[model samples]
Target: MKIALIGAGEVALCLATEFCKSEDEVVVLTSTVKPSLKDLKAEIRLTDYSVENLKKNLDDCDAVVSTLSGPNEFYISAHSNILEACRQSRKCKHFIPSEWNINIEDFPDQPMFSAATHEVVRNKLRSQNDIKWTMICHGWFMEYLLPTKKNPLREIGLAWAMNHGTKVFDMYADGLQKVTLTSTADAARAVLAVLRDSINTGADLPPVTHLAGQTLTYRDLFQLIRTRDPAWKSNPVTFVEVLTAIHEGLKANDALVAIHQMRIMGFTNANHNPKGKALEWGTGILQGLRATSVEEFLDQSEAGEDK
Candidate 1:
């Protein structure tokens, strides 16, 4: 299958690598191509994400997968154009939007980013029928726990829910809320599995697909960290504190509002646990695929550090 990836970021690169492993033709469209993208066995096309450009580029593609992400306006606009292009494409029928997080449908208008970006795309897709699309929600990326050198994900230092150096973590609703974590590589494999199944059975992909490498509460996660480092302290920000932080962050237009909101969603059971058809389908398709567990991920990180 000829697949067109709408962005050249780590997620898209991961997908390209996985798809290429099957010897499928992969074309990555991006405004700026990173050096790592050249290392992949895929064609890289430099182009703006305009509707006309995407339509022309995706004309012969069998599937379109977007991994684009940015500010609200840019993300919404780019995805809108990509969806329209897919609709008008001659052969492109399957599309996977850049929804690599939780089920935005469950919690509407929260986490400002989802409200502005994902919700807009969902609304657009609701009104369209030309393109068959599915949103893959894999909870949190386990890569965040590892350093950039140890993983394919780009580093965003100290922006994650856990701060190992400080021995502090966000305790969302008593730190008992279950949050799913999946490695990018594993998520990519699950996506390909779904696509293959859809093509083989001539069935439409589920509206939302959930893939979980490990699902554990913050308390459980802390215990795992303790297993690695016996001295690791658990200084957690209480649920009330998280709520207060979110409110204050929003008032000050703080970037941390998104993080706090994510914690709240997990606490509220709206984003953490995966259920229904989405979970069943993803788990069924990934039966034989051994997903990397949180324990395995920590072991890998430790091994990388030892080197």
Candidate 2:
């Protein structure tokens, strides 16, 4: 199957890297045609933000997947443009928009403008009949959950903020709120499965397929940490004060505050709001699809760092 991937961002790179090892054809459509990207195994074409170019690019492909990321307004126009192109596409049949995180439709009152734009794109997809679409309702990225030199866990924008040091520290929830997260690696695999099924079986993928590593909370994550280091401590915190601080941060135009709020939603409202049963329905749907648990991923990551 030929796949027209639109973007070269993190998610796109992950998908391209995996797809290159397969027999299927993957052509990346990017606005910036760089010299560095010239050596990639996959084909490259200029998207130039034009529908005609995208339609031509879609001519030979069986599926179109967008990993483009930008402001909500960009999505409102860009995604809709791609969908419209696919609507008139001579060959393209499957479409997966850049909806890599939690399903936006679940949280009707989500604060971020991007969520509203995603909902708009989704609604547009629903009214179409020419192409079939599916979204991976992943909770959060496991890479984001990990403490990095770039994104330290102590920054408070993490679903699991326990690796913050030995302060016997605090967090925003009482800790039983089930926070579900998945790896970009896992998500890439799921995307491949859906696309293959759509092309080969000629059947539409589920409207939404939720993916997650584990349904553990901050408290459970802290306990997992305690297993490796006995010095770790846990304490509950009032969400109101934290939310107040977040609101102030938002007013000040801090991007990190939006990240923090998303983490909060994953920890608190994820279970009830984006009510999904990835564990139940997604368990045996795909062959050998192992959804890594939080403990497994963290333990493995720590050991790798130690090595």
The sequence of per-residue lDDT tens digits that candidate 2 reaches over residues 171-209 is: 556777655667666777777776887688787677777
**What's the lDDT for all of these models?**
0.75, 0.70
Off by over 4 Å in 1: 148-151, 154-159, 275-284, 304-307
Q: Enumerate residue pairs that collide in model 2.
A: none
CA error at residue 189 for candidate 1, angstroms: 0.8
Quote each prediction's TM-score. Answer: 0.89, 0.83
RMSD of 1: 2.5
In lDDT terms, which candidate is top?
A: 1
Best by TM-score: 1
Q: Weakest 10 consecutive residues, lDDT, candidate 2?
A: 150-159
lDDT of 2 at 302: 78
Tens digits of lDDT, candidate 1, 28-113:
88898698787788888887889999899999888888898887888889988988888888888788988887655565555554
